[model samples]
Target chain A: MSQGSTRKTLASIAHGRSGDKGNHANVAILGYSQDAFDWLIGFLSKEKVEDYFKPLGVTQVERYLAPNVRGLNFVLKDVLAGGSSASLRSDSQGKTLAAALLLMPLPPDCPARLFFKG
Target chain B: MDKVRIGNACGFWGDDPQAPAHLATGGNLDFLTLEYLAELTMSILAHQKAKNPQAGYAGDFITVLQSLILSLKAQPRLKMVTNAGGMNPLACAKKAKEVLDQAGIVRRIGYLTGDDLLDRLPDFIRQGIALENLDDGRPLEPFLSRVVSANAYLGSEGIVQLLEQGAEIVITGRVADACLTVGPAAWHFQTPLEDWNTLAGFSVAGHLIECGAQVTGGNFTRWQEVPRYESVGYPIAEISSDGSFLLTKPQGTGGLVNFETVAEQLLYEVGDPSAYLTPDVSADFTSVEIQDIGSDRVQVGKAKGRPKPPLLKVSLAYRDGFMASGTLVAGGGKAREKAECCGQIIREKLRQANALPQEFLVEILGAGDSLPGIYQRNDPPEAVLRLAARDPSKGIIERFTREFAPLVTSGPQGITGYTSGRPQVREVFRYWPTTIPRDLVPFQLGFL
Candidate 1:
């Protein structure tokens, strides 16, 4: 909770492909295309997305996708929760930085919906 | 307690044939366990069962037993347990006993039955146990006709009954993989049923070694760093009465026993870490700790178990409809984009010919530009495209198969791997996994 420790944790997480935020969690959303990909970069790259993440205790965003499989794999860091690993209500670490990554709009008639909603 | 050593050979039917002989001759094993069944394997066995009652079990089990007859006879103290029984444990055991008789081994072979619920289907339905699909939670009524094999994943108690009956070789159907290990532990330690932590430890040990070589490092992500790949050794769980275990492999054998391999098996097919469902116990995988004991050895401890779920997961596969699929390679400069476009083209073609059904789906595989960040390689030089679809209508499925080959001759990628000809349309039997009241389907254990 201290400023110095928060700074160090942020720095450590930022060292990942997805950089770190001061006290918030880090999240990355990988995509199959540029329109949504650009939006994600713009969204996570902006201050509003950063501020929105702080309320839920998110920190940073990183995204990547497999060109061969048409599949996207993401890494969310320092979310209030441990991301998808553990139960949310039970653990404070369960909050995730990649929460906004899921909210980004998708291209019309995209197959990604089948994955997220399914 | 004296060390109870069990060797596992032949992870599946298609596994290396020399594994059993090497393990039997090499290790001072008290028991040899061979696992040869998966959920999909039962369907193939059921297809065989439909033709002949005695034809469902793995034929490779007979071959392995015949090969090991001399070695097994030489070591009278060594026993064997396996679920190679597949859909028909009794038939499999009968055949094994006949083999032993012919070999003059004279060992008392036993068959563990009552797990096969083919005859009790209507009784279970009438009693109001709604068999639902685990993935979708749909009732089993829709695909009941296509049901091929229905068997409960019975625990070690069933296998233990055979040991009590003086059977040297016990054959079972669809028992949980870990149960093979737990049965020996229960018999040895006499651990009470309510002592769940011990059961959890036993289950975890069984789970680690069940896949044969997984815990011993065959499937580790860093397999390249592994010492020996060609002679990769199967796993062995050296358990203690206190419920801790040291996992290792045979001396001088191939494979790595480290943290990574154990972790992979821990995460395999896991739904929840705290409440992993199994027949013997609901293991808390999260609580467990894994550490490398030494070279080719892992120490696993602290796995906790909770009260088991009320209902057992029964995998029942019935005949739905027939369908088949074949792969065609698509390659070009823009293979990823072309593959996606090919999926759309196939569906449009099927719809145009009035062959595509409402439930038709085409999935494209190996499309580059997917997971763009992980690989960090934006444009692959080229990629292979795989397209698959399914439909209830057999004729429609058959019709859709004819559309792929023509795409190669006329489509963007004129060069394709369509030498196999048209895909065969085969029936897709639906699967049912639901819970039945333990009281209603009380297991009847016997030794034969």
Candidate 2:
């Protein structure tokens, strides 16, 4: 909430994909560079992601780090109603979950200058 | 570096049919892998087999083979591996043999069976294998009557055996998708079964290319950077003996094979980067390194592996229910409001008729409600209203399908885009992921 600070979405600094594991969905968010990855590690906490996808009725959320690829994978449990054959949702397999998560607003005080167009 | 090239052309059953011939002709490779089965594909094949004795395999593969007959004849050294034998490997192999004969190309065709455990369910139960669902830990007894297909994901051992026996084409049923690549890599390098590190590396390579064009720019996050999607080249892994490989695509073809593209694919459907479970080895994807070496080329190496699990994951699908989805595009000023109103009308009508389904969902496509939480838009010009439902009774789903058509005339004025007719009702094959003792399900290898 600082003046003169720019606000940006996570999609501007990262890219990701999501897939289903039964009723659970895993979203892998990858940063464009090592610096962006470090920034993500410090900012994108489990509670933050849980709150972001709270509307989907996610029972639990666990984060895993892959430093080699500068990526963080968050598994959202019970997000899919019943998965493949059972789910009635338009994005049943959570294919659009990653894109939706990428729309998360970054903190105003974050290093916006470090980000580059991907 | 003693290396062998393996290219995966067909990712799933409905991938481009011309991909196999294109890869076989252009990619100077040792093996061409085609993965036809998805998680629920076996249930469909099982349903087909129950209807006809001679059915239940990926018939599209045979058609692809027919188209690739000239390429098969031209590239005699190029071998093929596939799990196109959805529920029936023998039948698929027989059809493939006939196709080969018609082209006068004499090549040994081998197949791996014993993955299908539907017939052996009673035996497994007698042996005290509970086959509980991996997700919910629910007992399999309640769903036994409706079980359609149950197949354990086999490893590369059978595929290696077939290749060692001079089988030019090896077909299998329900082998791990990665085994299609690992089998050839292990056979070519003569790696031991317990060589976990090398096997793990091969597993990672296999996983990358298992989805065919996925590793080579298809479904990439950075879609704009990808060169050509119309003629996207399938992925080819040039793997070395020491568990290293270069992920690349055929030259002069569309699509990219950069560091970002390969990295994105490495995490596709992946659970833990440290423990990517496969039948061969638990590949540690985090240890692997990827670097963009050149145009459409990525150097990927340092993939470590752990010991194979004592049990093999089984993909069991049973008849759960019937589902139907219908979509209607709403336009004009109050599109979002009209779409929600339309959904409520249908729900109320269904409630009044006592035909309410087990689960009903009304989604507004343009309202950013697809993911539900993040991107809610205000007052969209138009929106596609998608109404979907599932029920145990087929009659209920059939009834639900008819409700969409009536909405065109009876519903809100803004409602449109209903020319596609009533939504077709489809039988739901719910997936049941479980594990079986490795010894209980043995790989059966045979030649046609």
TM-score each candidate. Answer: 0.74, 0.97
lDDT of 2 by residue, B410-447 (tens): 98897899998989999999888899989888888899
- On lDDT, the leading prediction is 2
The residue-by-residue lDDT of candidate 1 on B1-448, one tens digit each, is: 6556666776666777777877777767777888897655777788899899769999898988988987887898888888898888888988898898888887777777767777787777777766766645687766666677788878778777777777788888888888888877766677776678888888888877777776666645445678877888887777877567888888899888876567656644343446667787898866787777777788888778987667776767766555555556666566656666777788788888887754543323444222211112233335655544456677887887787887786777534778888876655554445666555545554454
- What C-alpha lDDT does candidate 1 achieve relative to the native structure? 0.63
Docking class of 1: incorrect
Flag regions of model 2 displaced more than 4 Å. A1-6
Question: Quick one: best TM-score, which candidate?
Answer: 2
In model 1, the number of clashes is 53
Pairs of colliding residues, candidate 2: none
Docking class of 2: medium
Task: State residue A83's C-alpha deviation in candidate 2, in Å.
Answer: 1.2
